[model samples]
Target: MNIKLIVLFFSLYCLFFVASILFPIDFNWYNSLHKPSYTPSGKTIGIIWAFLYSFISLSVCIVVSMVESFKKAKWFFILFIINYIFNQLFSFFQFEQKNILLATIDCGFVSVTAILLAITAYKHSKTSFILLIPYSLWSIFATYLNYNIYLLNI
Candidate 1:
């Protein structure tokens, strides 16, 4: 495996990482909201996202390494890019903009794109697909949580 390619792929994921920092959660506003009893603590959510991002970075690296040509990885690439955009925007919508409804809608897009990216990566590398499974599941769960938050807040 090419270590440089792996680094490059992982670097691509930094966009969302940077966004999360830029749009750091506002605990004051967040704590004010009516959240579900099962809503995870901020620290728990942070830990989960850290793992998810690592998996996503590793999965993209695997797919990039296994594919013979860029064409083979194009769909996976496109889907992941879309997923990243939606993922990053969630912080902007939820924390920066403070719009739970928009955040909830963005979560749906993030979940759909994550699932599609995982499925698209399967043919190239099963390991990569497996790595993305948690990401897909997490995104879906996040969507559910966001939807509930929106409902409770409204």
Candidate 2:
């Protein structure tokens, strides 16, 4: 394993995680919202995100390490950037701005971009592609949850 590459990917994930923390979700406001009964508790959400981010970092490291061409590497980074932006924006919209509709849209973007990353990574590293499944599924679930929140709150 390339230690430097692992560090880079993990560092990038940490940056987003820290930024989300800095923005800080307003739990009071979030709790006030009309959430679905299936909505996970705050602690559960945190635990899941922690695991997902760690897996995402590992998957990205594997994909980045396996890319055989500069062009493919560039495309991978581009997709990563888009996914990162959408991931962060979901928190910004949901927690900071308290907009469930925009958050739902952001979550949708995250899900789409996540699957794209998985598909693209499939050509380079099957392990990387398989590793992304959980994140993609969780993103889809989160999108559904967010959409439901939007509907119920509307």
Candidate 3:
């Protein structure tokens, strides 16, 4: 395992924490909205995201570390970067901007990129691919939740 790559990937993922801080969820507004029946509690959502982020970071680290050169890691880098941006933007769209529609759209993008990232990871590192499964599944589930929220509140 590459400790440097692990640290770099994990540190990049840590920015999600910063994004959360910057776009703190407004409980009052969120609570006032009509949420779907299966919407997880905020604490549960937080816990799930924590797990997902760790797995995702580690998965990326594994894939990138296994690659002998940056050229070989280019696809992983592209997919991961796209996924990271969309992942981080969810808080900004849903919490800060308070836009259910935009957030729903963002969730779809996140899910797509996550699946792509996982598929791409499989060729380089099966461990990385397996690690990404939960993230991919969760993103799809989250997309469902977000879409329902949009429908319920619209």
lDDT tens digits, residue span 1-154, model 1: 6779767767866755887799988989999999899999999998998888888888888887788888978888889888888998999999999999999999999999999999998989999999999999999999999999999999
Of 2 and 3, the candidate ranking higher by lDDT: 3
Largest lDDT belongs to which candidate? 1
- Cand. 2 Cα-lDDT: 0.86
Winner on TM-score between 1 and 2 is: 1
Instruction: Provide the overall lDDT of each model, using Cα atoms, as 2-decimal numbers.
Output: 0.89, 0.86, 0.88
Question: Which residue pairs does candidate 2 place in steric collision?
Answer: none
Q: Could you tell me which 10 consecutive residues in candidate 1 have the lowest summed lDDT?
A: 7-16
Steric clashes per prediction: 0, 0, 0
Residue 146 Cα positional deviation in candidate 3, in Å, after optimal superposition: 0.8
Q: For residues 1-154, could you state the per-residue lDDT of candidate 3 as single tens digits?
A: 6579867777967966877888998999999999878889989999998988888877877876788997897988899988988988999999999999999899999999999999999989999999999999999999999899889887
